[model samples]
Target: MTTEEIEKVTERGPAASAGVTRRLGPATGRPSEASVLNVFSHGILVVWALMVGVPLLWVLWSAFKDSNGILTDPWGLPTVLHWENWSNAWNDANMGQYFVNTAIVVGGSVVGTMVLGSMAAYVLARFTFPGNRFIYYLFVAGMSFPVFMLVIPLFFVLRDFPGSSLLATYHGLILVYIAYSLPFTVFFMTAFFRTLPTSVAEAAMIDGASHTRTFFQVMVPMAKPGLISIGIFNFLGQWNQYLLPMVLNQQEDKYVLTQGLAMIALQQGYENDWGALMAGMMIAMLPVLIVYSIFQRQVQSGLTAGALK
Candidate 1:
């Protein structure tokens, strides 16, 4: 008999298909619990979205209002859209210079972190060598050291860094950021590297590919999801960095977004231009928002795939 006829016969027989199906869990019978959970999850998500969105929207709109209008009626909208707030924040407040400085620092550090961190992680995950675990543990150990603990020693280290003082230089700050960012990056990427299939890498090796070629051409492409996820994480952390630059980059001309914002706030003191401050914040936030939105899918997929491994 055909598959359909066999099924029909089985259903008609004393050995019933209904009984076999009935023996399965509640999931086979009904989705009431799943429905409830879905509704609950969606409700929580909506609440969380509002909690995040409301403040951001407030910041965006408040950037158009004058100081008095913002202070006197906090919830009210701007009577006239003040586009000059952005211009003033960018040029007059020196946020433009800070934005460029932040971009340069973050871009260099993120690229360095991803390259070095990925190499280290790939080796740790794939190769079996003497002191491999020891080296991996050493990198992992750096994560335990807090920024506060490092600040004092780092200050002296930068002050007397070999040939020259690395105290306030761009390269100095980039090096510091890379060093500080590596521990976590190495840890995360190592786990992700382990999750990737080794068969393709092995096949590449079998086909006369050198380790470097196989890694760069084969493994790296395969690990795109993980790399993109970790890259974004590193970028966000480096871009939003405040304390490191504040401590190391003391030059006013080399000040980053965070430092510039702090200076603006300090300079504002009593007579704060809330609108300009809001405009400055929006400028800083826009890039990060765009990045996350673009890579949201990759990030979700990467994290889940790593977790499954």
Candidate 2:
């Protein structure tokens, strides 16, 4: 292990010396670091996907089982494929009406939030008027406050809105959703708007483009990525809204998907129709799953594209 072995290895030439060195420690050195990391990462991702996916699959299969079947064989697949559970959830439970009400409210709110939020962001990002920072901060303050904290005051405000109360009305719910979504939308789009090049709007202005024209034709088109991102966020939030509708929308006919699901779950009582409940959960989840699957690429791209710019 001393000078004799060292001289013997050196006498064997560089290749043999390298072979001895290799035999002294790990045959493959640190090159497998990335490979190890890759496996580890994939392992983590697989675990995460299974954690999310297994529960969802359980819900989907349980929709096809009756109360007794579900309770008895909780982990097993459906034996009968009880499609009547869907019909019962859709027809008997009035999920159809709830879905329609949800679609209308969410659709209106997403549109309103996008339109108003984008315009406000444009003005705030581009203009240097007095109170611009103050106004931006005012909008941002909405995000800082919890929705629960504001719900009490908001309830009173909506109920006392002029002659007729806005409570339980479609427009009222839509307006409230828009108000809640705006802070995040405006904040996101404002940052995105600032990142956009000013030259396009300036060029449009030089060609005698009006302010409105420039905004609609020039700025809005450029900010489409940001709009898509915020629009999706607004849609998801408004679509799954429960508490707001539960409190404000006290009318039975005006229930959203979340409200309807809760109603079904609560109405289950001692003799619970777990199958129908599972079926209703799937019905509510379907739209969101479809939407996320469809626009996932756009969602990922639109949200991050501006940052790279």
Candidate 3:
């Protein structure tokens, strides 16, 4: 064989030996193995995306549907947009009032818990104090306990306060929510804070920043992902909380959305208003979904930051 033919044959040896003896047409480029793997991988991801998206889409569609539509075609699109359902839900169910009450409770709880939990986490993560591990474990223990177990004790403790019971009051619910949420928030923030470079704190200290100033101005900003994630979590928990609000807030005006929804449902035993019920649920869910969508990036980043580090 000529030298030129030998060189061409040597270049094709691996492809022929691997049983991949395929010739590309002049116009058609050869597909890489990487491209094939990516196609298969993207196919899996598309399936997963559909699995997650379909349910949310169904819920949104069903919110515009009436009872017969729900029964007959739960997955089908709405015949007519039921925008009035939202208005009715807001008015008839007193969801506007519930929204205000929920705002107060959720806002108060989120602020207090984040502030306290972040501070606690900062101290535990940065300083060498005695029993620090014990304190962290204590908070973790609180996380382990069932929320229901604390309700009875919390009820009496608030009940025995100076003039009136904390039960049925927004402040009481706020306090309870803060307490319940603090443990996990602290845990998350501590892990996140630990992941931060200590040099930032040291540099701030060198510049004559007090611990308080350094924390509020520098460290907290660095920990934004963790705080926002906890805020979203606490908001969802407080928003969806039924048993606590039901047991505590018996007054009509004081009812949070979840408890109000339950009462509406209970009343519907006589006359089931499925459209209204779905509307009420959609109304209750909208804020959480919006908040999640808004801060989803931060939440995901915070969740993975520990492992990433």
Off by over 4 Å in 3: 1-56, 66-76, 300-309
TM-score of every prediction relative to native:
0.81, 0.84, 0.76
Cα shift from native, residue 116, model 1 (Å): 0.4
lDDT of 2 at 52: 93
For model 3 the TM-score comes to 0.76
Error of 2 at 110 (Å): 0.4
- Model 2 lDDT, residue 184, Cα: 81
**Which candidate's TM-score is highest?**
2
> Which residue window of length 10 is worst by lDDT in model 3?
21-30
lDDT of 2 at 77: 92
Model 2, residue 305: C-alpha shift (Å): 11
Q: lDDT tens digits, residues 1-309, model 3?
A: 266579899977885664343334232344456457767998999999999999877767877877677666777889998777677778876887888898889888888888998999999889897999999989868978987888788778888878888988978889888888878877888888999999988999999999999999999999886787777777777778888887777899998888878888787552565666678777888888787667776656644543553
| lDDT per residue as tens, model 2, 47-104 | 9999999999999999999989888889999989999999988888888888899999
lDDT for residue 299 in candidate 1, whole number 0-100: 54
Deviation in Å, model 2, residue 161 alpha carbon: 1.2
> Which of candidates 1 and 3 is the stronger one according to TM-score?
1
